[model samples]
Target: MSLSGKEGGCDCGAVRFRIEAEPVVVNCCHCRQCQRQTGTAFAVNILVKPDAITVLQGDPAPHEHPTPSGAGQTNFRCSDCGTSVWSIYHAAGDGLRFVRAGALDDPHAVTPQVHIHTTDKVDWVAIPDDMPSYEGFYPGREIPAIMGEDNAKRFARAVGRG
Candidate 1:
């Protein structure tokens, strides 16, 4: 699962990223924010170490939002494209970094291990086969792919542990 040289970019190609290692916590998020931001039912996010994830092009900015849980989560975005390339969450004194899953050049390399925020998930959306489910958010992807620690804390916080 070591990505080593995998690369991905934003929709307009204004922003690009390089993953030096395999992602740890890659999953499809069905939260309302994800649906609104991606303009789709869900968003795929790849969690990797900040050190492992390198933005190859223009620097992205963090768009901060107060989640329903009240913890602060920052979506790292491309200033020009306004694409939420990544997100960082700081909660309980922890940090996690999450990359937009679809942003990867080879998205097939990773798959979501579970579904979260089922309560807010759209009624028409159906869960996948064999993937685990959580009524809310899982504390830590607790796997290799949940990249930036800051982002994980934010995710956990967003799920109400912040």
Candidate 2:
């Protein structure tokens, strides 16, 4: 979906942000870590460049958390309500950020292009056949096709991909 003027904030409105560009891709991660962190069946993340998001309000606190892979991620959360607004994985460093889809003003503006860690997905969850589902992470080579070509290129550049 187009993200020309997409905006969102914490539940308490302490922190607000705007997405300057279209997201590189959306993911529905069923990893156990994501489940425990979100306290849900899964988490939907919009992958985008860190600089692409413009903060229009208060600053959110960044907390370092460990993933199942042992690598870490820093979750930026609202200082007031403590809601997770976004996260930056160590693998991507500061170049990429995973914006919480539920934190968006219009959460439906973006949808998952792929479902990862499906093996750990809830038994009641049903995945659409139109979208690819992987027991683990999918290959980066196919990301360009899943996401728009323009967004994919921008993501590659941000993550230092050739």
The candidate that wins on lDDT is 2
True-structure lDDT of candidate 1: 0.71
lDDT of 2 at 92: 69
Q: For candidate 1, write residues 48-143 as lDDT tens digits.
A: 656777878988887887777787788888888887888875552234467887777887776776687777788898887666666777645452
**In model 2, which range of ten residues has the least summed lDDT?**
142-151
Q: Which candidate has the top score in TM-score?
A: 2
- Write down the TM-score of every candidate: 0.78, 0.93
Off by over 4 Å in 2: none
lDDT digits (tens) for residues 56-130 of candidate 2: 999989999987667799999999999899999887657888999889899988778899999999999999878
* Residue pairs in clash, model 2: none
CA lDDT of every candidate: 0.71, 0.87
